[model samples]
Structures are given as C-alpha cells and as structure tokens.
Target: MTTQPPPRASRPALAPRRAVGSRRALASRPALLALVVLLAAGLFGTAPASASGPASAASAPARAAASDVVAQAPGPLVWADEFNGPAGTLPDPARWNQEVNGSGGGNNELQYYTGSTDNAALDGSGNLVITARQGNPRGYQCWYGTCQYTSARMTTAQSFTQAYGRFEARIKLPRGRGMWPAFWMLGNNLGQVGWPASGEIDIMENVGHEPGRVHGSLHGPGYSGGSAVTGSYTLPNGQAFADGFHTFAVDWTPTSITWLVDGVAYQTRTPADTRGNPWVFDHPFFLILNLAVGGNWPGPPDGGTAFPQSMVVDYVRVHAPGSSGGATGAVTGLNGVCLDVAAAQNANGTPIQVYGCNGTAAQVWTVAADGTLRALGKCMDVANNSTADGAPIHLWDCNGYLSQQWRFTAGRDLVNVAADKCLDIPSANTAPGTRLQIWTCTGAAHQKWSPPAG
Candidate 1:
C-alpha cells in the first residue's frame, strides 16, 4: 500500500501509507476457469443493460449479457476508460497524468515510476498493462540511490474529481515477492491541505505475500498510517487474485464508503467507524493506479522473486449519484407540499420554500444531467455555500459548483452533495411559505422528498 508523504515544495508526492500489519489468512486457491465463469454469471447477474463502452474480449453472448452489469450496479455512467487501443500505445493523456518520479512514495518503495511505454502501455487485447521490471536502464536515481526497478503510477488528478459515486476497476494482478499494486484515491485538495488532513481511500491494495487477500482502508487526521481504519477480503476456496481478472470497487456516499470484490461487498465504513475523528471524505477525490516494488510493507524481492511482473487492467469506470437525469416535475417534501420558488421570483437568492402543489412554473423542478436541480432557469443552491446546519436554500445561477448539486437517495432524501446534508423544511413546518434549509441528515420526515418524476 502507498503511504506517500505531503508534497514538498520542490515536488508533489504521496504520503507514507500502510504499515506491515496482520493480514487475514488466505483461503485455498480455486480453479481459474471456475472463478471466471462464476464472475461472469454471478457478479453480473441478470440486470438490465446499462450504458457502457464496447464489450471486452469475450464471446458475443457472454459479452452482451455481462458487459453492462458493473455499470448498472451504480447509477448512470459519468466517466470511463475502456483501455481500448493499439498495442504499446499510452493511455489517453486527457484522462490520465502519469507521474514520473522515484520519491519512493514515502514508503521506501524501490521502483522508479516512469511515463515510458516500457513501464505502462495498452496491450492489443484491450488492457492497460503496467509492467514492473528489474533494472532501471536509464539509471534513474531514487531516494536510496540508483533505482533497482521500474514501474508506472497514474492519476486523474487534473482531469476529474467526484464527491460521491461508484468507482471500479477490473484487474488481473501481478505475483511473486515484493509486488505492490493498488487502486486508490486521494482528496483533490491534497496540494492545499496536505497528507492525512486531505484524506485517502484505499479501495483495493495487495502485497505480494498475500495472494488470496486484498485490503480496503481510510486515512485522515487522527486516524492515519498504521492507525487507519481498514478491512480485508479474501477469495473463497483459496483463490489467488493473480490467477484471473477480478473486479474491485467502492460505493461511496456522503456518509459511508463500502468496498467490494467481484461485486460482493465485504466491508462498509461509516462516520461512526472513525471513532470521533472527522469524516473528511465529504469532498471530491481523484483516482490513482500504481504498481510498486520492494516497499516497506512488502519488503525487498528475494532471489525467488520474478522479474517483469505486470498488472493488467481491463477498464476503470465511475457512476454518479442514483438520480436519473432529465426528470422534470414538482419536488414534494413534508406533508406533500411542493418545493417552490418564493413569490415565483426568478431573481438570484430568492428563497426556496414549501408551498401547495399547484403545478405552476414556480414548482417545476428539473433534475439536470449535471446534478443540478433547476427551476426558473436557476439552480437550487445552498445560500453562500454554507456548511452550517441551518444553511438556507435559495435560487442561484448555475455555475456548476458543488453547492448546487443535489442527489436523490433511495431513501427519498434530497441530499446537498457539498455539505453532505439533507434538504429540510425548517422545524417540520408545512406552511406555504416555510423557507427551506439544509441540516444534518437524520432520516427525519422533513428531510425526505418525492423527487421530480423522470
């Protein structure tokens, strides 16, 4: 696991992550073909077709049946990289920023991360292959001196960031001693806030010695490094993750994050899991994928360790909040009162309140594909972007800020994405002009809403 330190003025780096700790025991290895079949049949199940890119290198029937399952598990597809391209070509530059450094990732990792295709490239078979090989031919200097191995680390830091969603990757891991591969994310404010204070989410991590198990963890102030909250998932029947491709994912919401492998959830961490520490994951975070060698957690490669180990990634996909876009109708709250623009005003900062469902222009709310709840050509916004419990709700010109984004949860709660709170009718007042506000999500009746009909 990468434990990179704060970014130095001269260079940006990851905080030192994961310490050597007790791991869950390994199960017996299952047959590779059986695992693949099980994943195709069970993991995908028989869900309706979801919007996704081209199918993988599977048969027509199998691909048609299972290709959309992963994307369907979340909401609508927002971002994706199928890794489809000619052999030896690099990943799409617009979607990834490959870090070129040998800072050791603050974990004493031995690999020199390079942008060269030699370390990371697309295979002709629709996969992004990150190869870790012995010897740094360019004589790259690491923190310890000459680098002994070469690998790749890439992130979407510059291109994309999301607050709550489902992030997933299908990967076939590398084996042998000292191999460290991870699918994780760091808060977008890392450069400004620094280290644990910026938050880290380890969706999936595996050390070479633990072939049957993978870990998921959270790190933030007061509970980071070895003290980070974490859990492990082991493949049933002695399966080695390297034997075949497996899907690793995390479903993240404002209040909790759940980890899953092959579509089977193994652990769910919530605010209470922090033990009074802050839940710093309320903001957006960017994705990271990397393979390292000889880190402190995995130790150095022995003579028996193999050279040229590679992590093969089939695709990476993300889905936004569950609410369907393009839905337009009245948003009814407590006592079935429609959420209205006060006095039917279209001016900015006009208060939003509960009123009778008269089907007037004032009550027409549109759930835009970009996550905004719009009416009168303005977005429903948190007044002044406040995070306080009684932050007022009003109309504002849509600027695509987080404060204007609203997510309709399955529980019928209208959540303000930025503040991680619920839209509420103040004091449960159902009066026609009762101004609305945002308060801590307590699943109260006043916090629930009947979102716009699709």
Candidate 2:
C-alpha cells in the first residue's frame, strides 16, 4: 500500500450548518449488546432537547428507523472515506493520529498500543488493516496469560475534532479468542483531566467470542465500565458482524448520543446522565480505531485463540450538524478566566482555568438565538448556578438547567440568569499571557465580548 500525504491543513471556512430538521422516525429497537454496569450513582434524564428543537429541551428525539417517516431532511455528504489500495503504507497523519501509549491500557486490555506504522497499515485492496501479532516484547502482557501481542490504535486526536454529528465506520473483525476491535471517540480535552472525565463514546466494540454481536457505550466518571452506560445488539438470524463489513454509527448532538448498527438503534443518553458525574459526551471528541489482544471485557487469549489476526477497516466518515464547508466551533477554556489549562485538554473534573482572550478558537464561541451555545456542536453552561468570581464553567450533560441557560443580548453580551452576570473575562487584557477571569455583573468593558464572525 502507498502512504498518502496528509491533507494540507487550513483554516476551515464558515458555512451554514444543515439542521437535522423535524422529528426523526424511530428505528426498530435493536437488542442491547454492550453490558452497562450503571453505577449506583443517581439516574439522570434522557437528553437536554427534543431531537426537533433547541439544545435545552427536556427529552431527546427517539432513535430513528430507516423506513420510518421523517421531515424534509437535507442530505449531502458531510464526510466519508472508502478504504482502497495496498498495504504497509501509513494513514494520513493529518486525518488520523495514533495514540502513543496505553493510557493505563483502558479496558484492562493486554495489548500494547503504539500509534505506529507496523501495527496499522493500508492494504492495497480497499482496506485499512490493523494486525494483532503475538510474541512481540514491546507489546503488553495479558491479564489472563503470558501472551504478548502488538496492535495499533489510531485517532483524530490532534488534527480533526467533531462535536454533534454522525460517525460511522465500515469494517470486518478478526475472529479469535481475546481479540477486541473498536471504533470510538474521546473528548479532545482528555489530556487535561483524564478518562471518564473527558468522556468516551464507543460506537462499536466486538470481541472474538461475540461474533454476531456489537456493543455501544458511553463512559464518564459516574457511569463507566464495570459501571458503564452501555448496550449491545446482535444481527439478524445467523448474521455475524465479523462475517463482513457493516455500518456502525452514532448520531451525536448537544443533548444526546444515539447508537446504531446497520441503521438499527440500540441505546441513547443525554448530559443529565452526569447528574452525579455528568455525562461528559457533549463536546469535541476525536475518533479512535484500535485492535486489542486481551482486557477486562473480552477476557484473555486462551489456548484456542489465534495469533497474527487482522481487523479490516473499509472506511470512516464524520457528519456534522450543518451544511458542507461550514466551520464547526468550540470554546476551550485556556485563559485563567475559566481556570482551564493551556493545552491541557481538560476532562470532567479538571479545574476550569482562567486566561486572557487570546482570541484563540479554543476560546472563541457562538451562541444561537435559540440559546444553544454552539461550540463544537455542544452547549456550554455555568456549573451549579455559580456566580462566584471563581465560578466554574463546565460542559454538563445538557439538562435544561436554568444554570445551563444563557442569553446573548443585543447579539454579543452573554447574560446568565442563574448567575445574574454577563460572561466577562476579568481584567480585559488580550495579550496571550493574560488570564481570563470572571467577575460579578458590572456591564463594563471587561464584560463585553464580540464573537468572531463566521
């Protein structure tokens, strides 16, 4: 396979986003496949908004069915990839970034993951191949045995990030004991706080033994593995996901994340899921592709398992809420204003840092007239009615909280009813070195903020 040059990075253009439009028809419910170890933590609401309305609604739209009737939905390609060509070449670094470490090897899985070329390669014949080979010293040791395996983990971590949208991958799995393959996403802010806090979305995960079933899950502090908010599905009679390529996906919005396989809905969740820990899925998360050998979920490779197995990926595509060419945006708290760190990638519990308005896209944000603060396609809200000078602005599981509520008055000033204050970065200093802090309602220059025009 030939290595392709990463696409030239450029400032994305600002274009109109195509709305999902009126209600979506529900798809027949698929059986839950992922095991959800829902923590004893309190139960939260479904989603923030009606699938047909603003981001602050009380309930999310029901899962859509392929044949179910729907409103006039505008359809044009948002993003897609068709795996084609030879093997041994690397994926476009611009489009796909590999994770270098195991990050404590989440899932307790045994495979050592190197975002390296050896484990992940493109086969010349229309597929991105990920191979799990045994007896590699640089690989991880299994929790079940002495088996050593090398695998690849690829993601769009540093390059492209998406918020509310549809994410899908076409692929076939390798059948054998202890093999784990997944197409998932993690909040881009993970480096700041860490797992369960940054949030995780697993669109599909399959083990060797579960040939006919695929799993979908959402992980956060309060709800995660052993305590994860998960579900699964089994294909129609005698059909195995490992038998061939099938579309696995999730429709994400500011309010909820919906799971599907071959157009069948399995489970859905909203921000309120974070009532105790807050469902942290409502933000910019990068996509991940990996093939692991053994872990907590799939168990370990036994005597019957095979080595040198391969997971084939046909392609991956990301679809956002708006029209093509439109820029999707998010406001990351870098300045001291939010107590968020500089390039730290904050997760669920990271302290909100305060910094100056460097006018960085990470800090630039827009709020729709409908009250949805559309940054990375997720809503940004004040945490717990905090009007204190050090109030923390967090990305909560979108529950129509008055605390999550805000209004952009006269098109610029961000006024918060819960806090009775406007979004103002203290000590209005635009220098890259200044810290952005929040203060009481002063209606002064420090409180004035003009969002960059799209």
Candidate 3:
C-alpha cells in the first residue's frame, strides 16, 4: 500500500500503508503484570517521539496470559460519541470521517466501502451499527472476484489526535469466517512521515475465524506487517466476543502501551519491549474503525459465513491528563481527606469541601479530557459560576462553560481556567469540613494536590 514515492528530502515521507508481509509473529517475552489500578486524569507530560532514531531488533515480544488479566478503569472521559442519536443517522460528522471505496483495503478485502447509511448508521438504542451486507448494491466491481459485500470504514483523522492517555471503545463484534473487525490507531503524521515510520496501535482486532480471542499489536519500522509486536487474550468464560458488547481499550503513555479487554489488562509493551525498533508512538494518533470482509488474516468468506454481520459500537472516548499529570483520582491534602462534594448531591451550588476519604462517588475526582475536574458526572465549578477569588467550589452540571475548566500545575495547585485562581484551602486549615475556595496561587503546601496511581 505504499502508494506514494518517498517524499522529497524537505518533506515528511507520508503515504499509503499496507500489511508488511505474511509472516505471523509468535515471539515470546516477559508478560506485563495486570494493571489493576485505574488511570487518573492528572496533568502530566507524555514522552516525546524522536523524529530520527535507529531501528532495533524484534527479539522480545510483549506477552500476557488469561490468569494475569486485571480490570483497570481509564481516567475521566475526554471525548465521546455515545451514538445516542436518532435512528438511521450517520455518526457525528464532527467526529468521524468515512471512507468510500472498494480498493480492497490493501488486504485483498472483498468489501466495497460506501458512505451509504445502509452500511453504517445509528440504531435507536444508543449504538453505532456498522453492517456488512451481501451483493454489490453499489454495483462495485473488483480486480479479481465479484464484489460480494459492502461495509463502512471510518476514521477520526479530521477530528482529534492526542499524545497519550486512555483510548477506549465498547463494541459488540461480528463473527463467522472472513469477518475482520478492528479498532486501531494511526499516527497523525501519516501524511508527513508515512506508515511504519509514523506508528500504529492495534487496540483490538477480532477475526471471525478466531471468535474466542482478540489481538493487541504495535506496528512500526522493524515491527510492521508480519513481524508486528502482537499479543492476545482469550475469553475465560467460554464466550465469543460477538456474543455481547465488551470494552476494548489501551492505557497508552510515552513509553508503554497496555491493552485491556473489559478492563482486564493483558498486554503491556514498552520501548524496551520493542526488542529494538524505534518507538514511534510518542506523537499524536487518530482512531479508525471498520468491519473488513475477507482480509489476509481471516482469509475469505465462505458459505458458513453469514452476511449482514454487524459491529455495534456503544462509545469511543479519549482520556488525557489535565496538565500537571497529577494522576486522575481524588485530590487529597491534610488528614488524608479528599476534596469532595457534600452528601453526593448534584446541584448548581452544592458546596464542596475536604472530607474523610471513603471511596464514595462523591469523593472520586477525575481530571477529564476537557480539563474539568468531575465528581459523579458533574463538574467542580466556581460557586454561582463566578470568576472572583474566594468563590467557593461547588458541584454543578456540565455545560461546557469556561468556569469548569481546571489546570493542574506542577506546583500541585488546581487552577480554575476562568478566574485564573488556585483551588485554595482557606488559612491553611486542615479541617475536613473546610470548604474549597478560589484564591491567588502562592505555591502553598495546601495548594498542592495528589492524584491516584495508575
């Protein structure tokens, strides 16, 4: 699929990408311990990618076992589309860019991708239904066999791309021979640096031929194509992924990439885990989704395979750190109490104060992708939406108001974006009932906060 010639020396060599080769990697390396802890949305910096680095070997591959799985919650919601739109509607054009072609998807796939609602649309029940149907409804011909199927493929290329955090989606996969559904990512520099050099993360790939297992992989310079770093997790309960909706996610950071199925972390790949290839995941990357029919990995569809197979998407979201990387979770101070909403109430002016940490929803805080510190799906706001200093903190409904945006400073302060003030503990008071207030940032010890561990 390298359709373009290497770019001129002055330009990045970005172009089309296809599977590297036909060899499958079954190499073994140290397996990652289950990441049982949840990722906290702290404002932290991610590792930067090197524009030019020497390639490395593929001697060690990432690995994980079923017994090692652990459910790890990704931090606060960043960007999401619940597909909660009117039935038969196309996905949010603001978030998705659909592909329209039958060029075989570089894998000899037999599906003609169309922008028609018949192939991809929303179900009234809060889900994105991508269906693969039999016959050439569009009368698309192929280079080889008659085009026998049609499906939809889409990407977030025009919407968003972040360095790292948690990227996740809940999907009910399709099954039967030849059905290849994937949730993956491609580096944003794809138009500049091309594939392999830009990097790719396969969060989840399930071919109908293997209904019981899903794969997680990384593709780059030396690890592209047949030699990609790959690992998998099999459902322990003797169930197929197509049987129901399940979450597929990745806790991605500057140096490591951990894959999870339904919150259970199974594969963890780090720079050292690359076995020698240059690490290309340090840059921003966009997401892609498609139910490819008849690809190299799963072969072609057969009589036993069913048409009209679908991949139902519940949601797709991205969670990044606030700014200080304070790590996502309750922000605690003296007496080990956490910043909390009083009585689990949800109101426009519900007072927020320091409370003894009890692990209740009220005490749980998250630095969401939008920079809002949230508790119980509501945002930490300035009382009455005021921007004045001394305006007390409150729990309020999220309305995308500037008052809800917060910043975690390296100085351990939570600064409100609207007023440009710090979340202050009045008079250095260590009392649990002391309400949270906005004050001038003085780098005071009380102004510092701690987020939860990964």
- The local distance difference test score of each candidate is 0.77, 0.55, 0.70
TM-scores vs. true structure, each candidate:
0.61, 0.54, 0.61
Candidate 1 TM-score to native = 0.61
Tens digits of per-residue lDDT for model 2 on 1-454?
A: 1112112222111000011111122222322111111211122333232222344322322222222111111123465556564567887776776655443253455666665667888887878989888776654444445546678887777677878777878788888878888888777776665655777788888877778877777767766544566667677565777677777877776766667664444556666554577767667887788888776557788888877888899888776553112222333222334222344443432223345445454454454433334343344555533445756555434444444445333213455534445665546654443443345655475565433234
Query: Which 10 consecutive residues of model 1 have the lowest summed lDDT?
Result: 63-72
lDDT of 1 by residue, 135-222 (tens): 9779999999999999999999889899898898999999988999999988888878777788899989999887988988888887
Task: Identify the superior model by lDDT, candidate 1 or candidate 2.
Answer: 1
Best candidate, TM-score: 3
lDDT of 1 at 95: 96
Worst 10 residues of 3 by lDDT: 32-41
Segments in model 2 whose C-alpha atoms lie over 4 Å from true places: 1-78, 102-104, 115-117, 137-147, 272-276, 322-454
- Pick the winner on lDDT between candidates 1 and 3: 1
lDDT of 3: 0.70
Off by over 4 Å in 3: 1-75, 322-454
Candidate 1: C-alpha lDDT: 0.77
Backbone collisions counted per model: 13, 62, 16
Clashes of 2: 62
* RMSD of each candidate relative to the true structure: 17.2, 20.1, 15.8
